[model samples]
Target: MQDSDSLRGFLFDNMPIRGQIVTLTSSYQEVLKRHEYPSNIACLLGEFLAAASLLGATLKQSARIILQARGSGALKTVMAECASDNRVRGIARGDFKVCATQTGFKDLFVDAVLAITIEPLQGQRYQGIVPLEGDNLSQCLMGYFAQSEQLPTSIKLAASTQESAGILVQQLPNHAPLEQSTTDWQTINLLIKTLRAKEQLHLTHNDQLYLLFKEHHVRLFDAKDMRFQCHCSRHRTARALISLGEPEIREIYLQQELIDMQCEFCGALYSFKKPFIDALLRDQNKALR
Candidate 1:
């Protein structure tokens, strides 16, 4: 791999808080493997990929987190999803060719939303969509933590063809995770706001926090590997095709000789002939017995 990657969590033993730093290298290139995304949108995917990884690590249960930006701009939407297994994937929609020429944060995002969705393997899923805040993905996520979780959280993320990195700093809730107050959270958030892109992406996990809080004590934890993997297959595609309803499948069959579905994450294609479709339906019927 040209770009080695890692995910490390740190604990501030005496501060009543903990956080994570996520880094990616070739894995980012893997995201751009099959598509030609404009530089800005490519960077957006990387930022969201790092954000999703950081958020997924906070979950105690087996969960996946999806970070998405959606709006009416030339670049209509982009999404990144991270699984419990550390498998990551992302894609952008429409014309993702916009460039940011302004200096201010709000000038960058214009109109959009930062949506976080948590899906547990064996439980009901939940989603929260908040209006876009700040100029970039990091600030938008930090804004989310402030408004929704009130955790005094801050995030800084960077993306390039070679790598993607993100740093997260959040104060522990005064009460349980569910009962923390929004007032004190805002006060402590000021400290987190001091992070810069260079420090977040350049420093080591240990050094990053040490540099940020030289006056405080912090505990470091084991790191995990993060990589790119596509979770799509012919079987999955067949299952999805079955859900399309007979009418829809017939419509596809009418215009196309074979149904060829491609996986956006990995660029793998799954094509099904009419016979294969019939066999799938038969197998599905047999399995339902």
Candidate 2:
């Protein structure tokens, strides 16, 4: 279980390629426990969690990456976010009973578009959207890289109710000769394609890479721990409420004395009473003035 709830990076010493592997156990279960999801929806959420973790490792600065998809079918929307610090949270919204009846990606998500959003702690945020044209989440991600990033990338993702795991390999700007780099990339991709779901779920990070690239010299990096953490707080939630404007706040207050806000990612609740709301609005009015 060395790989459980951890992310590790690797480099191909002989080639200009790098990769990362992520496995989730306790964190995956933590997300599942917050809301009741169908088995299939839960599995898809796991893949998204693993994918976000793998993508977060690629960021050069402190940031958070979100992998989200929206559709008009039984599966309405699913989102997973992972920060540079490896804090992860995810949610799915749809009819679970209807979602359980479907199995294929397309069936579950008709007319779906996958969006990858990166929010840096300091810089502006960026997002890329692509049609969900592939058979699985892995293929959709590969298409996104090919279309948006223009990088040769290979991704494998697998998730069961018990565990979720993913691996991402990308060919960096060519350092080797064209022919050699092409051959190396193809060789590595072929080997990675041979990886089995069972191995991805059960093997240690070292063993998994060794099993795939024993013939090549691969350098594995130290493991980084990951955990389930919701970024929601009373302050953040209050800020969100303040965005509704004074009129909206007044209207809501007329219906109820306390404004209760509950986080969808984690079930933490934030309640704002009349006095607090009044002070908050006064501060906002002063700032505006």
Best by lDDT: 2
Cα deviation at 23, candidate 1, in Å, is: 1.1
Quote model 2's TM-score. Answer: 0.96
Model 1 segments more than 4 A misplaced? 1-3, 97-111, 174-188, 279-289
The residue-by-residue lDDT of candidate 1 on 48-154, one tens digit each, is: 88888888888889988888888775666788899999999888776443533333435445587878899999999999899997767776787788688665676
Model 2 clashing residue pairs (backbone): none
For each candidate, give its TM-score against the true structure.
Answer: 0.84, 0.96
What do the candidate models score in CA lDDT, each in turn? Answer: 0.76, 0.94
- Give lDDT: candidate 1, residue 177: 47
Residue-wise lDDT of candidate 2 within 43-154, one digit each (tens)? 9999999999999998889999999999999899999999989999999999989999999888998999999999999989999999988989999999999999667999
Worst 10 residues of 2 by lDDT: 144-153
Q: Residue 207, candidate 2: how far off, in angstroms?
A: 1.5
lDDT of 2: 0.94
